[model samples]
Target: MADQRVAIVTGGSGGIGRASAERLGADGFAVVVHYAGNRDRAVAAAGAVTGAGGRAVVAGGDVADETAMAAVFDLADSEFGGVDVLVHTAGIMPLAPVVDLDLDTFDRVQRTNVRGTFVVDQLAARRLRPGGAIVNFSTSVTRLQMPGYAAYAASKGAVESLTLILARELRGRDITVNAVAPGPTATPLFLDGKSQQLIDQIASANPLGRLGTPTDIAETVAFLAGPGRWVNGQVLYVNGGAA
Candidate 1:
């Protein structure tokens, strides 16, 4: 099993994270599914991976907590030999205009999105094996400049910066560091409270005329992790022309 590739997917308990974990599992990588608070969903994701004939285990941690995330990475190394890919799909989105957004909300978003990416990517930079890849999450709102997304967009902007700099810093290491900025993905996290009219409007904003599915984002992650070796230090916008 030393030749097997291993992935640590943060936020693997829900939505796009779940899809990415399952897809990577299908791609012949042993996955360590990391969740923040939901053990049941993490178990379910691990089960799906195992059912698909891939190796997987569930781990729980806050992405911004160094100790907790370090434990998750350790689990991957001990369980599957070493880490090869890291898909950081864990983040939070709270929609409020910049002027109206509370300081607490801004702080929370920055802690989870900016600080979380920093914590996780630092570990990946130190731990990923040769030829490994790191895929960090961003948001199309960064480009779309949509309303009520300033805090979220600003946080993702920092993620993009980290991703670009890390790829350059890892020269000669045969690793790729990139960010995927998805737009209007149709997950519970994106759709839970929106009115049907607003949802329809946003869905139609994309040229595809529909909200993006989790699998759509996962396909892009899989490419960066597995076959898309030449792509690095770039932000691939997976927004279906929404931007």
Candidate 2:
């Protein structure tokens, strides 16, 4: 096993997850890129880490499944000694007003966003090495109170609450638990099906006058995971002043 610290980033195939994984690798953590279904992208992310003079491996599992999550932990133990950091960023956003939101979509979103976070964090609480950190993903929409985001916002609200409580619960372990609430980021998922006019309008809504980038959020994650250890049990909003 590598003597370097190890970090496992779920949804590491793209967007904020990928960016955070890369940043953590560059920060000297041996990263494990976890993906649900994108093998190629996961491999690419691992390659990026290795190319940057860090150790990395690709692992796949459903974040919401206990058995799968157990396997993921096992992989980390066998491959990198043990997990020193855990970042839960795997989530699905199916935007719809509460009145029109499909039951299936709502359930899936809750499963991935809420339950997945709980499962992964439960494992982390039990297994993370002392001084390790757990970073959960939330949304600026939870504070922005935007339309068509009731379900998504509600899910992230749970994550925010969980992070705070988990921090206290793990107080003896010296593990810091925190959440990053990102605003309108320019990810593929966010850009899909949006016109330039709509995108520009959204950009103007932020004080920064542009949508957030994955790197923007990733930098915050890196901080909370690294030298920002004192920032426990808080939701650091990286929305360019949108909230």
Best candidate per TM-score, number?
A: 1
Clashes of each: 0, 0
> Candidate 2's residue-wise lDDT over 25-72, tens digit each?
999998989999998999999999999888999989999998999888
Score each candidate by Cα lDDT: 0.95, 0.92
Instruction: Report the CA-based lDDT of candidate 1 relative to the real structure.
Output: 0.95
Task: Write model 1 residue lDDT over 4-119, tens digit each, in one string.
Answer: 99999999998999999999999999999999999999999999999999999999988999999999999998899989999999999999888899999999999999999999
All candidates: TM-score: 0.99, 0.98
Worst 10 residues of 2 by lDDT: 1-10
**Model 2 misplaced stretches (Cα beyond 4 Å):** none
Record all residue pairs in model 1 with backbone atoms less than 3 Å apart, i.e. clashing: none
The lDDT of model 2 is 0.92
Error of 2 at 89 (Å): 0.8
Per-residue lDDT value at 138 in model 1:
97
